[model samples]
Target: MRPLLVVGGRELAARLRDGTALLVAVVAPIVLATLFGFALGGDDDPPLTATIGIVDDDGGQFPASVQREALQTEELRDVLTFAQYPDEAAAQAAVDSGAAGAAILFPAGFSDSVGEGNGGSVNVIESDESPLAGVVARSMVDRISSLVEARTYAVRASLEAGVPGDQVQEFVEANGAAGPSLTLADDPVSGGQVDLAMYYGSGMAAMFAFFVVGASARSLLVERRLGTLSRIRAAPIPGWTPVVGKMMVGFGLALVSMCATWLSSVLIFGITWGDPLGVFTLILGHAFAATMIIMLLASRAQTDSQADGYTLAVAFVFAFLGGSIVPVYNLPDFLQSLSLITPNGWISAGLTELAAGAGIGTVVVPALVLFGIGSVAGVLAALRLRKGLLS
Candidate 1:
């Protein structure tokens, strides 16, 4: 038992001294996760309302009519929050200065043009920061403009076809909100939105945590190359001491690295991870699963290069399958079920739920799944080690 402890300590010290473990565990995750957060639409802030600046220079009722009708539209009501402006320049300034997320400018002749049976256009000025919301607002303007155009067309046809004045008046009244009736509302599904910061932060942390293999496998394969493995095998040190030591080294580093990564995300980025105790438990299970899987892979490899190849291949496949690259909720049902078998998926899902403001208790199932995977793999790896397969 003392010999096993000595072996574990030596493995740990050697890994820390070389610096590879630190780089892979700490620096790589932070950098890559920032890239992911940026790619997924920088800043994890979900939009509240389509705060828009309106420049209605139409000098007629159309602009007011559009706003009036927009208020009655339930879908638009969910998103539209307005600030009116007298001109395009002021409206654009509001958009640029962040006073408004988007801006709409109706030209002076807009109503007149529509009234004359000519379609009119409005300029939608939006910041690049809120591209999705800007586009949605622009579509809203297009819809309102179409409704106005349809009303105008009906009036024009009535006059041209020699319809009586009373009948033409009736025509205008009946077609006011006509043309196309549509609704656009975001699905209010709870936890439907994935916060980019948490998504990538948790993903990169779990994905790189598996690099514990690079160090652990080195301890095993290096001993074999130097014939230390056979010497230890024949000595009173016991056949399994060296293997246990190396596995301990990998498991300890992985758990520590994952915990550190998760903590750093909260402290440095001001990211919120709910329920500290629950998060710790889940992270521990994820690390355990990662270590066991890596151990098994290391057991099958003959040389350092083969071990490295196996690590990279397994890591990438696990990352892809486990929701490291995409949210599992966004995946098809079959894929989501398959991902449950991977540690990456479990950790990712747990983090995503926490990010949505659920307490840590919500993640118990995933953590338990991870623990089960680790236990099964750990058993299989132990059997292989007993058969002297790591050589």
Candidate 2:
């Protein structure tokens, strides 16, 4: 045990003195988290608003009613402001000049065509600068058109059912003026909010923790090349002592990287990762998993270059599959399920729960699973290293 501790201490000190290790483990993750957090808009961003131009060529009841209905809708009014234009040309100009995000042109004789039971066509002009606004405008036009069609069908059916022709107009007006029967309202499940900063910060930390441990594990090959392992073998140390020492170094480095990233995120981005105890438990489980997985990969490689390649491949694959590059909720269903098997995924999920104001007990199951994965990998790595060293 003393020999293992000494070996681990020596390796850790060497890693600390190396500038590359410090840069990869501590500096790069923080910088990337900051850039990503800023690039993606935060919760404080103002709500989207756009102006829509309306060209009333028909100047008739249907077009007037459509405009009146859209303007009166409270939900649409919040995000959409209306501007009246004299003609299609002026509306197009408004869109081109960025004065309007989109335009709806009611063609001449539009009301006459609809009154004759022939559907009228409405032309829409959109601006390239405001695509989201254009989508909203398009949806609005489609909704109004559907409502008019429904009213026409209702009036036709009432007339066939022996209702007076004068009463058909009343029925159309009553139904057209009515609002939707059902509307959706948002009800969030989580008690707390997770902004872009907290999300990406946790993702970057989980992804980089693998690199931190990988570097330490790869150092075994470096020491072997330098005849350091041979010199150590000549001493009274056991064969497994060096392997345990290397594992210790990798595990220690992983923990340091995770903690540093957490601190940096809090200081720079003002991110609050809820429940300090939960965060620490997640970090411990994730660090252990990263260290053992990298140790297993390094133990299989014949050379330092091969180990480096393995480390890069495994780290990136795990990161991508584990929601480091994209949110798990946004991933395809198959990929979301696949993430459950990765240590990175477990850590990301734990962090997300924590950010949502879940207690430390919420992360216990994930932490246990991570520890289980690490234990299996650690056993395999130990066995493989023991065989190689004895041989």
Candidate 3:
């Protein structure tokens, strides 16, 4: 036990002392996380910025009140940039050329219909190029329609109560929509926060874990070439000592890599991980498990190049199957179910749950499964090391 610990300690210290390993295990993940978080718009409320073109063909029939109501939506204020156009042709031209995202054309009788409490339709033309812009245009149209309907209701109420026409119109104009025009119903309690963190963080961790295999395989090659394995085998230490040492060091590197990635996400990009303590344990445990598979690959490869090929193949294959690049939610059912065979898949799932505010207790099952994998690999590596079969 002491020999294994001593060997593991030396390997950890050597990784720390090596500038390249330190960069890969720590600095690289941090940089990648920071870059991706900002560029991809990490879970913080996305800034609303869309270009819109408005063409009022109704000869000023579209009420100023409708426009005001449309502008009042927080989504419009944050996510959309509105531009008024005189006609559909010009708006179409702007949209075709990519200058505008969507166009609104108010029909000839639009204002009179609203003024007279009659329902009518307007043309909302959106550029197929920008789905979000189309959504924004539709949303603005809904807000305008709802506000007008609400005002119509208020006016009808006043008339029912024998209020004067002028007073009723004034009341509807003044107080119809004093608050938010859009209420985001069905908004999850936590909003977009968890989804964003889980996807990026888990993907980053899995990708970097692949990188650790390279370092571990290199260290294994060095041991073989320098006769370190021969010397360790000749000593009165357990055959498993070297394998355990390598596994421990690789696991620690994986943990450090993931931690650095998450830290950069939280601090630099202002990403909010749901629960820090639970997330930390989930990441650390998964890293340990991932290193087990990496150690097995290291044992199988006779040369650094062989290890490199196997590591790349395994990492990419598993990462893809496991939802590193795409969420499991988007995957086909069979593929999603099949992904469980890979460590990356389970790790990704566990992290997703953690980001959704699940505690360590919720993550325990996956953790145990991952540990079971590590134990199995460790036993295999120990057997191979004892027989001098590790190449």
| lDDT for 138 (candidate 2) | 68
For residues 16-123, write the lDDT of model 3, one tens digit per residue: 787756887777766665665566556464544568787876775344555665567754556556787878888999999999988888878776666555656777
lDDT of 3 at 384: 62
lDDT of all the models against the reference?
A: 0.74, 0.77, 0.69
Taking the tens digit of each residue's C-alpha lDDT, what string does model 2 give over 171-243? 6676563334211121011111455677777788888888888887778888888888888888898877777
Pairs of residues clashing in candidate 1: none
Q: Write the per-residue lDDT of candidate 1 for residues 85-191, one digit (tens) a residue.
A: 98888888888888887887888888767655566778788786554346455656777667667867877887799877557646666656355543442211112
TM-score per candidate, in order? 0.63, 0.65, 0.60
Worst lDDT 10-window in candidate 3: 184-193
Clash count list over all predictions: 0, 0, 4
lDDT for model 2, please. Answer: 0.77
Q: Where does the lowest 10-residue lDDT sum fall in candidate 1?
A: 183-192
Residue ranges of candidate 3 with Cα displaced over 4 Å: 43-198, 359-361, 389-391
Off by over 4 Å in 1: 38-194, 329-334
| TM-score result, candidate 1 | 0.63
On lDDT, the candidate that comes out on top is 2
Q: After superposition, how far is residue 273 of candidate 1 from its true place, in Å?
A: 1.7
Candidate 1's error at 207, in angstroms?
Answer: 0.3
**TM-score of decoy 2:** 0.65
